[model samples]
Target: MSATVKPRYQQLKDMIIERISSGELRPADRVPSENELVELMKVSRMTANRALRELTDEGYVTRMAGRGTYVSDFRAKSHLLEVHNIADEITRRGHQHSCKVLRQSRQRSRGKIAGALHVEQGVDLFHLLLVHYENGMPIQVEDRHVVADFAPDCLSQDFRTITPSAYLTKISPLQEAEQVVRAVQPNAAVRRRLRMADDEPSLVVIRRTWSHGRPVTFARLHHPGNRYELTGHYSPPGTPKSATGNVVELEIYDHE
Candidate 1:
């Protein structure tokens, strides 16, 4: 399979960001209008609009009701936590990454689905179900829900070529996220899809990602316990050996 390519909108975003990084697009400088971008990049109007809208949402640009868009006095936010892309991880491990998209559709959120995305009940949303593979072996099953408004083009992407994770990151940079990890037995269908033994449990990570102060995506990611392992390293402040330490320190915050 051909290597996954960055979406056109993301390419446009990268171009503008590179300009900003190189000091060509200074803060408060007028950014090219959507029409200008359409003419310059040869992308569709929808593509130009999405790129700019996402840039505004990500604080890379500011848009005025009447005036044109302009570069913002943007301060990049540090990622308090890192969310690794599965495809990148697989490639780093010298393995091929691929996925099968099982379900992709729009639906109304109900019950826990609504609560998970932090949206009102019955809000229309996009749902995706995928089974990820490493070297042709199934490793994970991901069930994801995205806020429809945040990703208007969610339904059109050919997910078999690009992962939902990669696509969503381009929608808007992650502002915040919450995660819950658990070990449990998944449903028979998922277990079979992962090729797990009947007695094996699954390692599950339930994640909710926020952008522009709104939860935009909620996902349940499951891995076969027998074949998958979770690893991490912690480098705390002022620790000489922390950089290479395998021990992770967890912080507990008081409700007060």
Candidate 2:
């Protein structure tokens, strides 16, 4: 560690993230208490307290008055590729789907978003964040970045009435999509929006689509693991003349 790495508090906060990434920490697992961390890491009380405080604020740990802090679930394991709407995905499982728009704004791209869209350091980008409900319960939180080049009229649409998922499909047919999945704890802001419990785990899916050889949009969909699942089917070509059995399985990254 560098002498002037982040503050001890931030370093401790990062440690929680590292442990979660390594599976050393897990959802519902009680994290080391501030006193425990101080004794183990040989840090000051203030440093230990800062780490726990930040972790709680970041939604990486849940702190109880009398009980110790517990780890949060930050990974989505079930991955599948299928063309379906967010509403249909939930309703298929006997759950109702509802969405609430928390924010819709126009901003310039930054960091990796700018790089991915191949735009300048600051280019107009449409941003949206929504909370999805299932059977009157929050299930998924969606955060998206739109490529203005493909959907110039997106800003004019009213997301309060129509979902981004539905709107995008209505305007453009699927050309190509890329998706990725990983475990990530919700930030403080997202945690509250999803109404996630202290013990619940969260899954994040990042998707990007392209049309006319140009990037169309990017989305990050977060799901509560306890109530969501993804499924898909596929068949291989030229699979004839099978005496007993000949089957090939496929793996699809649920994205875009």
Task: Using TM-score, give the best candidate's number.
Answer: 1
C-alpha TM-scores of all predictions:
0.62, 0.57
Residue-level lDDT tens digits of model 1 in 30-108: 9999999999999999999998888887778999977999998856644344446778878878999999999999999
Q: What clash pairs does model 2 have? A: 74-183, 74-184, 75-183, 179-255
Cα TM-score of candidate 1: 0.62
**lDDT value, residue 88 of candidate 1:** 83
How accurate locally, in lDDT, is each candidate?
A: 0.86, 0.75
Prediction RMSDs, each to the true structure:
14.3, 20.4
Model 1: runs farther than 4 Å from truth? 1-83, 237-256
